[model samples]
Target: MRRRKLHNLQEEFINKFLETIENNEEYLEFINRHKPELLSNCDIAIREVKFFDVFNNTQLNNLIKGISNLNKEKYSIDLSLMSKKYKDLNYLIIQYDNSSTRSLCEVTFKDDLFINNVRAGFTQINNNQAVVEFSISFKEIMTHNLWIDFIKENKELLYGKKFFGYYNIGEMIKSAHFALIYNSISKVIDAALQAKLLSVFSLNFGNEYTLPQYNAIHVPQEHFKKEYFDNMFLCRTYEINNKYLIVDITSDEGLKMDLYFSGLYSSINFLQLLARYRMDLYYFLFEKIERFEINRRVNKYFLNSRKRIALKDYRWLINKIRSLNDNKLRENYTDSRELLEDWKSFYDGKEEEFIDFENGQYTKKYNTIYSECFDHIKMAYSIQKENLVIYIATLSLIASLIGIVTTVLLG
Candidate 1:
């Protein structure tokens, strides 16, 4: 049997609906502007990407070998896309879909790593921050379970024991159809990435999702709802109105439709944007913790009572507290006008955590300083008053003695 090439299928698929889908000049222009730059350094521009550290020679070699060993005549998991490489990463764009429209289930999980591209945004985490431009009407659906089994076989040989929980292939069999893209990635990558490949998937799909009874982790059905996705504002979904450029998908509730897009090529950029602020929030937390630690240590020293705290020391402590004020940074990040309202909202929410940290820890520190300083000031005043009183008493006693002596002499 002559195997149909995925490129031919993609061309046919795009051409069939090309007239309706290609009408968006704005989106087309956007793609045109960025596509060249994104694809310039690579041989295969349409392949999926897998990232690896340059130092992980063992993992990288195994990945390349797996791709080399694939039987070209078999399933639609195209090996051609995996041929290209740039630096320590490989691009393996999937041109085939293995899941049906009615089959894909709605899932809700918080995955920080899936969209985390903060180091350099698009330039750095390109391996993990990918755009899966898929249309729901698959020209072919391969056995997703077969690909899953392929990943399980690589548990020891490719991924090793440290990444066992990460490769937890068991969790994926439930949504096997929709998740095949990730599962295929597990096997196709021989060894280039050092844990990040699995990390990307684990971070993407690990926490919240509903699988069929065959694969359920026992989440109650009543708890799941479409409203859950409303809170997932950070999640970017693009739909194809027409057949050519538009991507298609089915809702977990069994609704079938092409995903519509206002012309953002991918959510990778959005992920990067949020990642920047997420990094800021993380640093903010780190600083707050450090301030708390410093306050604790200083309060302990003040409690000792033997060490003298002077007026100047009180001023220094106040200055240190003032320095911990991240008000400006908070204001800058939580800008209402500059950023999207949802992003701004997220920033504000994270900033609240910072405020709570400051309020709780700093309040304790302030009270300790206030009590210690107040007692020191009061004790100093008392000492001066006691000296004055002693001097007056001595003078009075001398005067009495002088008076008595004079009287006796005169007599």
Candidate 2:
């Protein structure tokens, strides 16, 4: 649970960091100099081990520990040969490729065990010289996120094509199979299983389903049973970490909460990639908002002119305005008229009072969007005050107002 909480916190931190950098000029300049190529390549391909077989090995305990060690955790191996003294066993082996995508293998040879089944198949190794390694440990395999981090932090040295395998030492002598054949067969089975899981999960969230937002619905858990989705959704709220509370749509318990959350995480990751690449878009819009407000006040042409801007320009402006409607600005925007009044005061040569907001550096910085949107609408009102009769310009200004209203009402 703690690890999951930390994962959610890390995700939130990444999003806020993306937002902050995109909104700041000096910070962007720093990025262009230091890490400009970050989002240059976004066409990523994801593949995984899909199948494997259960084989007998004298060193199964050591092998599982080897898999666990790839994730930065130390493991002590315990091995037992079916001698007269001991007979209990629970062990696993994990095989992965150069990208560090993994497949799990479990072996339970105890006579008293309830479950016993083994499947295997073959897959080609892309790198001939790659060495096979494993992690054998007592630590739970639940923290897959941290394990990926361990591989990524050392990817340069770890690159190699590989797959998974489980060898049955007890059957090898009788079966007459080579070591390489055992490895190949096990990986094939593992790959098939992995593929099945991915297929089922992917289809569950395809285009037709729209996950519900918990914040929009009130589920009465007291009268409804767990079998009812509404009650389940409300009960599931307790399972969500605070860091994921505001943004996680899965808390509402739609058709498939697990897949919804997984897709949501992937979507956020893709957005971060966009944030890294189109950082200039953010800066451009932020500056545009400021300059537009300041120009409306200082330039007479902007105040009297009734020119309609392009639809694209209006859309960009609308998105920027909506961004300011987050939780941080909810209270500030309670009275829209008052909000606009304060913004007008800031624009009419009171720039110093609003410097903190203009720069997106105020303590109430989360309210930066609210402040920016308010200032923008107020500026538009001031611009059209004299010539409200010009239909195009009047409509343009009204369109901007409608953008904010639509975002608040529907978003």
Best by TM-score: 1
TM-score of 2: 0.16
Candidate 2 per-residue lDDT over residues 1-411, each given as its tens digit: 354554454344333333333454544454456452322111111211111111223233333343333222221213222222233233322222111222333332233111122211111111111112111121222122332332233222211111111233324333533333322322232222333222212211111112111111112223222222222232222112111112222221221112112111211121221122122212221333334333543243234454533344445445444433322222232232332232211121122233122323432442454356446555665565555567777899899999999999997
- The lDDT leader among the candidates is 1
Model 2 regions more than 4 Å off: 1-315, 328-363, 385-411
Residue-pair clashes per prediction, in order, are 17, 34
lDDT of 1 by residue, 49-107 (tens): 22212112333333444444434442123222233343344432221111111111111
Alpha carbon lDDT at 100, candidate 1: 12
lDDT agreement with native, every candidate: 0.30, 0.28
**Candidate 1 weakest lDDT stretch, 10 residues:** 209-218
